[model samples]
Target: MTIREAFTDLINQRGWYVKLEIPEGTANSTKKRFLEGKPVTEDKMKEILQRAGYRIKQVELWEK
Candidate 1:
């Protein structure tokens, strides 16, 4: 699934919301953009997943 889809699912499953210290207008705008399927940065995605108690692992595969 796409990142946006996964993010949405996680948010729904965990009832997660952005609670930044920014102004209400900016926060609302960000939420709107996110719901509109705007692309999220990789770093931001990692941060969110980490905050949700998820761990990321990288594994290398070699082909013979």
Candidate 2:
């Protein structure tokens, strides 16, 4: 599947907006391309977070 197609799939699966912030000096090749407004395969999402020391945690949801 194409990169954009994969990203679309991820968005659908999550049912929420996914945003990954790359701190300064940590943008790898693929991530740099993504940050520079280029199309990046969504498969890199996991690797990016893993490299950045992020993990998934459940949190309470609130409706306001």
Candidate 3:
């Protein structure tokens, strides 16, 4: 399965949050490359996930 599918399964079936942790000193640069100044929307996320062979077709909102 793709990384996106696996991650979705983690939260949906396992009821967990997928948090990525970076090395202590690399956090700042990593944020600038990924998190900083980047829009956190479905499209943007899908683009990032696509690099790992993830093609998001649909999204379901949960009350959890």
Top model number, TM-score: 1
Greater-TM-score candidate between 2 and 3: 2
RMSD of each: 4.7, 12.8, 10.1
Candidate 3 — which residues are off by over 4 angstroms? 1-39, 57-64
User: Residue 42 of model 2: what lDDT?
Assistant: 46
Whole-model Cα lDDT of every candidate shown, in order: 0.57, 0.47, 0.43
lDDT of candidate 1? 0.57
Q: Of the candidates numbered 1 and 2, which has the greater lDDT value?
A: 1
Instruction: Estimate the TM-score of every prediction.
Output: 0.48, 0.34, 0.28
Model 3: worst 10 consecutive residues (lDDT sum): 13-22
Instruction: For candidate 3, report its TM-score.
Output: 0.28
Model 2 ranges off by over 4 Å: 1-28, 58-64
Q: lDDT tens digits, residues 1-64, model 1?
A: 5545555665555225444334556545545667777855767765666676555555435798
- How many residue pairs in model 2 have overlapping backbones? 0
Model 2: how far is 2 from its true place, Å? 21
At residue 56, what lDDT does model 1 achieve? 53
State model 2's lDDT: 0.47
Q: CA shift at 57, candidate 3, in angstroms?
A: 5.0
- Per-residue CA lDDT of model 3 for 1-64, tens digit only, reads 5444443443343212223332434434433444344534555445435543546565655795
